[model samples]
Target chain A: MLRALRVASPLAVVALWQLASSLGVLDPSTLASPAQLARTAWELTRSGELPHAVAVSARRAALGFALGAAVAIAAGTVVGLSRVGDAVLDPLMQMLRMLPLFGLVPLFIIWFGIQEEPKIYLVALAVVVPLYLNLVAALRGVDRDLVEVARVLRLRRAEAVRHVYLPAVLPGVLVGLRQALGLAWITLIVAEQVNAGAGLGFLVNNARDFLLTDVIVVGLLCYAALGLVTDGVVRALEWRALRWRDGGETA
Target chain B: MTGTDLTTPVVAAAHGVRRAFGDHVVLDGVDLEIRRGEFVTLLGRSGSGKSTLLRIVGGLDQGAEGDVRTGTAPAVVFQDPRLLPWRRVLDNVALGLRGPDARARSTEVLDEVGLAGRERAWPRQLSGGQRQRVALARALVREPDLLLLDEPFSALDALTRISAQQLVRRLVDVHRPAVLMVTHDVEEALLLVDRVVLVDDGRIALDEEVGVRRPRRRDDPDLVRWRTRLLGLLGVADA
Candidate 1:
C-alpha cells in the first residue's frame, strides 16, 4: 500500500493539474494541461527532434563535466598535499570562487565566442569550483592518526596515497561530484538559453517565440528527468565505493 | 663496552636523545637500550615524554637531537586502533607487508591473534578489543625486531584490556621481539614487561627487572611489592 501511494502521489498531482486546466483555473495559452504536454512530448519523440536536442545537450554536459572533474581532482590533490601548492594556488582559487559563476557567462562568451566552446566552458567553470573545494577539504580532513600509522608502517609516498589518502578522500569526492553535476546542468541550461543554436534550451526558446506552452513544458520536464538520472548515478557510485561506512549512505 | 652483558644483540638503542618544542622541553637527554626478545615498558606520567621517545625510535619523527639506531624497522601500535576503515581486517593486518604472500601471512597472523575467519569484517564492525587485536596482528605480521606500543590497550574496558594484555603476553612469548611499550598503568607494566623503565622529567629515573615467574597471580607478594613501588614512582599515594 505504501509502495502504491508512492506512485500515486505524482499521478494525483498531475490529475489535479489537468482538472484545474480543464476548469480554466489555469489559462491554456500560459500553462498547458498535462495531457497537452504529454501529447507534445510524444509528437517530438516520434519526429526524433526531441532526441536529437537531448543528444546534443548530453554530449556538451558529459564533455564539460569530465573535463571539470579531472582538473579539479588533479589540482585539489596538489593543493591539499603540498605546502608550496597551497601557498601558490589556494588563495587564487578561493578568490575566483567568490565571484558568482553565473556572472562569468558573458565573460566566457566574449572570450570564447558564441559557439559550443563557450557553452561547454561555462559548464566546466561552474562545476570546477565545487569539486575542487570539496576535494581539498576532504583531503585535508583525513585522519591524522591514519597518516601516522602509514608512516609507522613504512609506506612510501605513492603507497601512502594509495593505502591511506585516496580511500579517505573518496567519499568527499563523490559528494563533490553530486554537487558539480547539479551545477553543471544549471550552467548548461543558462548557457544554452544565452547562446546555443541547438539543444533542449533551444527547443524551449523556440517554443516560447511561437507561444507553444505544451512544448515548453516537455523541454523543462526533460531537463528535470536528466538531473534526477545523473544524481542517481552518483548516488549508486557512492554506495559501492564507500561500502565500509556504516549505513552505506555517504552521499 | 660493558663486557659482562654483551651476549644478546641490542635490537634498539638511543644515545642521549633530546627533543624540545620551542620553549618547552619534552625529552631531555633520554637514553634507552633494548636487547633481543626483551619486553621493556617505559612507565611515566602523562607528560613524561615516553611517547616522544617511542616516535623517535619508530622513525616517525626525527626532529630531536640524538642517535637512534635499530636492528630493523620497528612496528608501532597506537592508543587507537588506526586501521584504514576502507580495508578489511586482513588487509589492515597486511598493510605493511607486500608481495603475493602478504595475504597468506596476514591470514596466519590473524589466526595466531585469535581473529581467524574474520578477514572480511570491516574495522567498525569489530569490538574495541578485536580492533586492537587486529592492530597487534598488523604489527606482528611485520616480524619486527622492535615493537613500539604507545598505550595500545588504554582505550579498552578493564576486562577487555586484561584479555588484550594476555594476548600481547602470549604473542610476545611466541614472536620474541624486543618490545618497548609506553604506558601509565603500573599494573599493566608489571604484568606485561620483563623490565620497567620509569621515565620522568625526560629521563630514565628507574630501570628495574621483574623476576616474577610466569603465570604469576596478581596477588603474588613479589608482584604486589613491585606494583606498589612502581605506583609510588608514578606519584600515587597508595597501591
Candidate 2:
C-alpha cells in the first residue's frame, strides 16, 4: 500500500498538471504540458540529439566524480592516519573548504580555458570538500576500543588498516559520496551553462533560445533521471558493503 | 587441541608490577602468578585495580613499572564483547589466527561455543549472551597460553550470567588455558575460580584457595563461607 502511494503521488501531480494545461489555467509558453514534453522527448530521441548530449554529460560527471573522490580519499587517509599529517594539511583544507566551489567557475574558466577542463574541474572541486571532511571525521571517530582490540590481537599495520580502519571509514565515506554526487550534478549544470557546450546544459540552452519549453523540460528530466540512477547505484553498493549493518535496507 | 600438562610450567608471572596515575595509584607493587591449566579469580571493589593488573599482565598497559613473563601473548575477553561490528562471526573469531585453514578453525571454535550455525551472522544480530560467546570464541581461537577475562559476564542479566559462567568454565576445562578472571561478584568468583584473590587499596588483601572440588554449587557451605568472607572484606555487613 505504501509503495503504491509512492507511485500514485507523482502520477497525481502529473495528472493535475496535464489538467491545468488543458483548461489553459497554466501558460504553455513557460511550462510544457506532459503530452507536449513526451512528444518532444520522443522527437529528440528519434533525431539522436538527446542521446549525444546525454553521452557528453554522463562522461563528464563520471570522470569528474572519480577524480574528486580519488584525491579526497588519498588526502583524507593521510590527514586522518597520522598526527603530523593532520597538523600539516587539515588547516589549509579547512580554509579551502569555506570557499563556495560553485563561484569558482569563472576562475576555473580563466585558468583552464572555456572548455571541458573548466566544466570537469568545477564538478571535481564541488565534491572534494564533503568527501575529505567525512573521511577525516570517520577516521577520527573509529572506536578506541576496537583499535585496542587490534593491538591485543597483534594485527600488523596493514592488517589493522584492512580490517579495522577501512571498515570503520566506509559507511561514512559512502554517505559523503552520495552528498558529493548531489553537488556534482548541481555544479555540472552551472558549469555547462557558462560556455558553449555539447552536453545536456547546451541542449537546454538551445531549447530556451528557440522557446522550445518542451525540449528544455526534457533536458531537465534527463538530468533528474541521471541523478536518480547514479544515486541508486551508490545505494546498491552501500547495501552490499554494509551487509553487517542491521535492517538490511537499501538507500 | 594440544594436550595441557598440569605441571608443564608457569603460564604467567607478574613481579613487582606498579601502575599509577599521578597522585592515585592503581596497582601498587603487586605480584601475581598463575600455574598452567589453573583458573584464578581476582575479586575486588569498583576501584580495586583488578582491571589495571589484568591490563599489565595482558601487555596492553606498558606504562606500569614491572616485569611480566608469559609463555605467549595472552588473549583477553573484555567486559564488552568488543567484536568488530563490521566482520561476520566467523571472521571476528579468525581475526588473530593465520594460514590457509583459519576459516575452518574459526568455524570449529564457533561451534565449540555452541553457536553452531550462526557463523555468518553479524554481532548485532545476536543477543547479549550470544555476542559474549563470540568474544570467548575469538579469544580461544588463538589458543593463547593465558586467557584474561575482565568482568566478561558483568553486563549480562542474572540468568544469562549463570549460563555464560558455565560456558567459560567448560571451555577452560577443555582448552586448559591458565585463566585469570576479574569480577566484583563474590558468588561468581567462588563458583568459577580455583583460587580467589581480593584486591584492596592497591594491594592483594586476601589470597585464599577455595577447597571446593570441580563443578561446585552456589549453595555449598564452603562457597557460602567464602562469599561471606569476601563480602566482609568489601565492607558489606553479612546478611
Candidate 3:
C-alpha cells in the first residue's frame, strides 16, 4: 500500500500539472506542460544527446567521489588512531571544512582553468570534508572495552583495526558516504554549469539561455534520478556489508 | 584443565597500590596477592573502589603509586558485558584469540559456554545472560593465567545469575586460573570465590579463605556463618 501510494501521488501531481497547463491556469512558457516536457525528454533521448550528457556527468561524479572518499578514510583512520595525528591535522581540517565548496570554485578554476579538471576538483573538495568528519567520528565512537580486549589478547595493530575497529565504524562511514554522494551530485551539476561544454548541467544552462523550460525541467529530473540511483547503490552496499547487524537493534 | 601445580606461589601481586582522581581517592595504599588457581572476590560498597582495584590489577588502569606484577596477561569481563555491537558472537569470542588458530579456539570456547549453535548471532540478539556468557567465553578463549571480573553477573536476573554463577564455578575449577572477581553481593561472592576480600574506605577490610570443597551449597553451615560475618562487617543484617 505504501509503494502504491508513492506511485499514485506523483502521477496525480503530473495529471493536475497537465490539466492546469491545458486550461491556461498555468503558463506553458514558464512552467512547461507535462506533455511538452515529456516530448522534449523523448527527443533528447532519441538523438542520444541525453545519454551522452548523463554519462559525462556520472563519470566525473564517480571518479571525484571515489578519490575523495578514499583519501577521507585514510586520513580519518590516521587521525582516529593516534593522538599526534589528531593534534596535527584536526585544526587545519576544521578550518578547511568551514570554507564552502562554491567559495573555492573560482580558486580552482583560476588554478586548473576551464577544463574538466576544475569541475572534478570542485566536486572532490565538496565531498571530502563530510566523509572525513563522519569517518573520524565513527572511529572515535568505537567502544574502549573492545579496544582493551584486543590489547589483552595481544592482537597486532593491523589485526586489532581489522577485527575490532573497521566493523564498528562501517555503518557510520556508510552514512557519511550517502551524504557525500548527494553533495557531490549537486556540486557536479553546478560545477558543470560553470563554463562547461557537454554535460547535463551544460544542457540546463543552454536551455535556460534559450528559455527552453521543457529542457530545464528534464535536466532537473535527471539530477533527481541520478541522486536516487546513487543513494540506492550505496544502501545496497551497506546492507550487504552489515548483514550481521540485521537482527540486532542499532545503538 | 589440570589443577595448578600448587607450588607456583603467587601468580599476581599488587604492592602499595594507590589510585586517586584529583581530590577523590579511589584506592589507597592497598596490597593484594593471588595464588595460582585461587578464586578470589573483592566485595565492597559502590564507592569503596572494588572496581577500581580490579581495573588496576587487570592492567586496564594504572595506579598512582604502586607496582603491580602478574606472570601472564589477565583477561577481564566488565559488568556491562561490553561485547562489540557489530560483531557476531563467534567473532566477539575470537577477538581474544590471536594468530592462526583463533577461529577454531573461538568455536571451542563458544561450545564450552553452551553457545555452540549461536556463533552467528549478534550481541544484541542475545539475552543479557547470554551476552554475559559470550563475554565469559571471550575471556576464557585466551586461556589466561589471571581472570579479572568486575561485577560480571550483576546485570542478570535471579535464576540466570545463579546458573551463570554455577557455570563460572565449573569453568574455574576446570581451567584453574587465579581469578579475582569484584561484586557487591556478599552471597554471590561467598558462593563463587575461594577467598573473599572486602574493601572499605579505600582499604582491604577483610580477607577470609573458604576451605569448602567443590560444588559448594549455599546453605552449607560454614558458608552461612561466613555470609553472616561478611554482612556484619558491611554493617548490614541478613534478611
Among the numbered candidates, top DockQ falls to: 1
Q: Put down candidate 3 lDDT per residue, B1-239, tens digits, no spaces.
A: 22334576887889999999988998888999988888899988889998888888888775457988864868888888888777788888887465798999899888988888888888889999999999999999888889998888989999999989999988998998899999989889877888888999899998767776656788999889988988998989987
lDDT of 2 by residue, A1-251 (tens): 99999999999999999999999998888898999999989989999999999999999999899899888988899999889999999998898898878778778878999778888877888788899999999999999999999999999999999999999989999999999999999989888877756999999998889888898899999999999998999899898889888735321
Residues A89-137, model 3: lDDT tens digits: 8887788799878878789889999888988887887788989999999
What ranges in model 3 sit over 4 Å off?
A: A18-39, A78-84, A248-251, B1-6, B22-25, B99-101
Q: What count of clashes does model 2 give?
A: 0
C-alpha RMSD by candidate, in order: 2.7, 3.1, 3.3
Candidate with more favorable, higher lDDT: 1 or 3? 1
lDDT of 1 at A237: 88
DockQ for the candidates, in order: 0.52, 0.46, 0.40
Pairwise DockQ winner, candidates 1 and 3: 1
Ranking by DockQ: 1, 2, 3
Candidate lDDT values, in order: 0.88, 0.88, 0.86
TM-score of model 2 (CA atoms) = 0.93
Leading candidate by TM-score? 1
Estimate the overall C-alpha local distance difference test score of candidate 2.
0.88
Error of 1 at B85 (Å): 1.2
* Candidate 3 residue pairs in backbone clash: none
State the lDDT of candidate 1 residue by residue for A1-251, as single tens digits.
Answer: 99999999999999999999999999988999998898889999999999999999999999999888887888898999899999999998888789888898878888999878988877887788999999999999999999988878888888898989989999889889999999999999988888778899999999999999998889989999999999999999887888898733321
